[model samples]
Target: MAGSLLVSLSGITARTLDGCLDLATALDERGVPLSLLVTPNAEEGHRSVSDWVRERVVQGDAVLLHGYDRRVRDEFADLPAHEARLRLIAATAALEDTGLRTNAFAAPGRRVSAGTLKALRLHGFAVYSDGSTVRDLRGDRLLRARLHGFGGRGGAGETARRNAFVLAAARLVRRGELLRIGLRGADLDRPGRWSALLDAVDTALECGVVAATYVGPAPRVTCSPRGSTLTSVPSGARLVNRP
Candidate 1:
C-alpha cells in the first residue's frame, strides 16, 4: 500500500470550532479526510460542541482524546501533583464516554516528558502522537513523523524548505521508510488561500512525501467527517487523528 496523508487540527478554539465544523462539512463534500484534536479546556463550556462532533463522526472521520487540560503549567500549576494526575484521569474518562479510546493521549507541544508518557500508558493509551513519531510502548509500533512547513503568504517558500527537510529526514529514518509529513495552508481562522495550500501539497506529493495537517496537539489516526477524500491529497499521505 502507498503511504497515507493524515490531517490534524489542534487547539480548536470554541469560537472557531463552529467554523471548523463548517469547514469539515465543506471538506467532506470535497472528499478530504481529516482528524480533529480538541483540548480539554476548549471543550469546557462546549460540551455541545463535542456532542456535535461525535454525532458527525463518520467512517472517514476519527476522534482521538487529547490531553487532560491545555497543558498550561501556569493555570494548572496550583493543583497538587496528585490532583493533576486525577485531572488527566478524569479527562480520559470523559473521552472514553464519547467512544474514542484506542489512540488517546497527550500532545504536549512538540515534546512529551517521561512522566507524561508514563501517565498516558497508565491511562490506557495505545498510541501517542508528537513531533517525532508514533510510539507504542508495548508492540512494535514505532513510526516517525515527517513534518512539512506552515502555510501562509510565503507558504510556498516555507513548504519547499520543509520538503527539503523531510527528504533529508527520510533518508536518515531508513531508505523507503514510511514517513508522515505535515502540510498547512492559510490559517483556518483567517481567509484560507486554498490555491497556495494546494500548491504546497502538490509539491510534497511530487517529491514522494506523504503529507499531513494537524489541528490539535495529538495526531489524527483517520480522515475527517468533511469531504477529506475529495481533495487530491495523494494516496500516500496519512491523516493523523487529533481531538
Candidate 2:
C-alpha cells in the first residue's frame, strides 16, 4: 500500500458553527486533520464561528474561503455573482484578520466560471476542490472525483453503492501515482454520517491514497447527535501545509 493521504470538507454554510465544531473536534480526536472552507457571508451571519475556529483550530489546519450564498441558477444572477465574488474577498480578509492565509478555494455546488477562477487567482489561491474534480489552479493537474452518496436526498443502499464505486476508483488511481482523497459531508448531517464517510477514507488509505475531509467555516467544538468525535480520526492520514 502507498502512503496515506488527507481529506477536506468544503462549503460550510453560515450559522452552522455547532456542526463545524462538532465535526472538527471529532475528526481531530480520531487523528484526522480536516480542512475547513468558509464563505464570507457565513462569517457575516455568524462572526463568532470564525473566532471560535481561529482560537480552537490550529493554523494550517483549516482552509477558509467564500461559498455561494444561494444556489447558482441556469440564468446567472448578477447580485449573486457579485455577492459570491465579494464573499471570496471577504473570506480572504477575514483570514488575514486572524493573521492566517489560505491558498485553497472551493466553490459552492462546484459551479465555477472563468470569472470565479480569475477571482481566485487574483486572491492568491492555488488550488480548488469540487464534487466533480480537484483542480490545481496554478498548475495543470486535474483529478476527477466520483461522488459516492448524498445524505440529504438519498437512501442508505444507494449511498453505499456510490461509496463503493468511488472507493474502487480510488484504488485504481492509487496504483498509478500518489493521490489525495477529498471527502465532504456536504449533504450529510451529524457525526455518524461523517464516521461513515471515514470508511471511504480508510478504503482509500488501504489503496495508497492520502485522504482529507473539508470542514468548511463551522466552529470546532459542537457535538453531533451520533456521538461523533473529530479528534478520533487517525493523524497519520492528515496532510498539512501543502501549497
Best by lDDT: 2
The residue-by-residue lDDT of candidate 2 on 67-102, one tens digit each, is 535444421123344545676776566555544456
Tens-digit lDDT track of model 1 for 145-241: 4444353355446555545545554352233233343332225544333333344434434445443332222222332232122222111112324
For candidate 2, give the lDDT: 0.50
RMSD of every candidate to native, in Å, equals 9.4, 10.2
What candidate 2 gets wrong by more than 4 Å, as runs, is 1-4, 11-16, 42-45, 56-60, 68-87, 94-100, 147-151, 155-192, 206-243
For candidate 1, the lDDT comes to 0.48
Clashes of each: 51, 45
Q: Can you give the TM-score per candidate against the true fold?
A: 0.60, 0.61
Model 1: residues with Cα > 4 Å off, grouped in runs:
42-45, 71-85, 96-102, 149-186, 200-243
